[model samples]
Target: MTQHVTVGIDGSVQSAAAAEWAAREAHRRGLALRMIHVAGTEADALERELGGGAELPGRVAEICDGIAAAWPGLDVTCEVQPGHPAYTLAAASGRAELLVLGSRGLGGFTGLLVGSVGLRTAARSLAPVVLVRAESGRTDAPAAATSADATSADGAPADAAPGDVVVGVEGDRPCDAVLEFAFERAADLGARLRALESRPTSHDVYTTQAPVEQAEIRESLAAAEQVRLQDALARWQDKFPQVRVEVEVCPWSASRALVEASRGASLVVLGRRTARVPLTGPHLGPVVQSVLHHAHAPVAVVPHH
Candidate 1:
């Protein structure tokens, strides 16, 4: 079976943007694109607006047509499923190369940046889920345009140099899946990989100790952290020699550091740990949640043990 890129679609602008992003990714990866629409909830109303039943397929067809137009030569397919949106989308991830969804959906509080369906799907999906906001714009652009013209207000390129992938490293529980995904993406794009490790400052040690002791303690801790981070990345770095690796060790909140790094990143990769107790449900860590809500680039939430 050919694994294709999948995106959950409703009538929302965000989902439309996700479909476009997924189409571009599928084309770049030489894979097909699947646009999935789960019936029920707000989608039912959308179906009705599109004339329902026979006419509903037209709406999906229209979306597929637009994607085909945007990404010529790319294979695209559409499906309408009947079930809870989150559960259906999560189940579809099992067979997809990657699952993409919008950060915000239609049936949610205005202030909630990420909707419940997207959150639940990201937490439960076995495959990596990429959350794209409408503002992410069309990712299918010429290399020159994407690398040089997409700029911030200050006239700096919005994305990482030309090809740069950023992955957040958790020292306590470094996820192999996340690291592998980052390295693989960088290798595929012939890009550079940046591994970011963040640790909270030891405020107590600094506050209670003398200046000399503080200097010694801080230096000691920083050295140990650098060594640990290098050890964690050693095997992977060796595995992908083609990918130039850069390691950043920061004394700050992981979320803040990752979010800041994402400003110029092609993609921000983070790990979602499965809940030990199934009944407690999926546990998306604070860092992952914060990055998803704030990162400027598309965020990939890779689930790992």
Candidate 2:
């Protein structure tokens, strides 16, 4: 069966770009395209007054029309909803094969990756979420050239597979679920899977340890941590021998490590923290927010079991 991809459109430029990217992806994957507009609190009164008439639903239709025009003969639907954008988005993600959105919304001031609805949605949604950001002309243009060369050099078909799936592997046990989800996605795409892990730095070690003997002890503890990361990767390797898996172990912050890994990756995978846990909500957490904001690729946040 064809995949079903849904993208939230708020009539913003970033959302429009997301629509365009989602439409292209839907066409490329032979999937259905859905355009959704979640009416914000500010727009609730307007929605009640207009009731699916022009401006609200009409704008959504325009965005969908643009997508349809770009990829003629593609499945497309437009919808306008009332209530919180994030709640509607999270609920819509339940049955969607994939969810696409822009990094920043109609709001103002977008830095490299500060904060936005895209980050929140990516953190909570069970479905894989793609955050479409403006791409650099020079880097984005070389895809055709690189693809052609890849096929010619390796005897690999031009469309041999889809894109690489990147998953974050922390020392935390919950990351096991993240690895499993990413491996499954890689299997589906016939793409490679990359597992990235980040450890604390030696500088932090020096600061925390005062005595020479204590410093040595801390060093040993850090080394053990790295060893645990290797063991985790080994388990994944044992489970999915056929999948091409690349493991990255570093001593940087988890967010920075993920962002670096996501540079050329098609999707970034993360594990969601439990709500009952302290400082584990979708919007909070350093590593979660960092990867969501900074990574150029789409992110897939899976719940911890």
> By lDDT, who's the top model here?
1
Which lDDT values do the candidates have, in the order given? 0.77, 0.67
Model 2: lDDT of residue 295: 70
Provide TM-scores for the models.
Answer: 0.82, 0.70
165-247 per-residue lDDT for model 1 (tens digits): 89999766678999999998888767789889987777665655455777787888788888888889989989998999888
- lDDT for each residue of candidate 2 in 67-186, tens digit (9 for 90 to 100): 665555668887777667877887788878778887652123435453457666766776767777655432322122222333322232234446678887765563666788788768
Identify the candidate with maximal TM-score.
1
Please report the TM-score between candidate 2 and the true structure.
0.70
Clashing pairs in 1: 160-264
Off by over 4 Å in 1: 42-51, 54-60, 105-111, 136-163, 206-213, 276-278
Clashes of 1: 1
Span of 10 residues, lowest total lDDT, candidate 2: 138-147
Model 1 earns a TM-score of 0.82
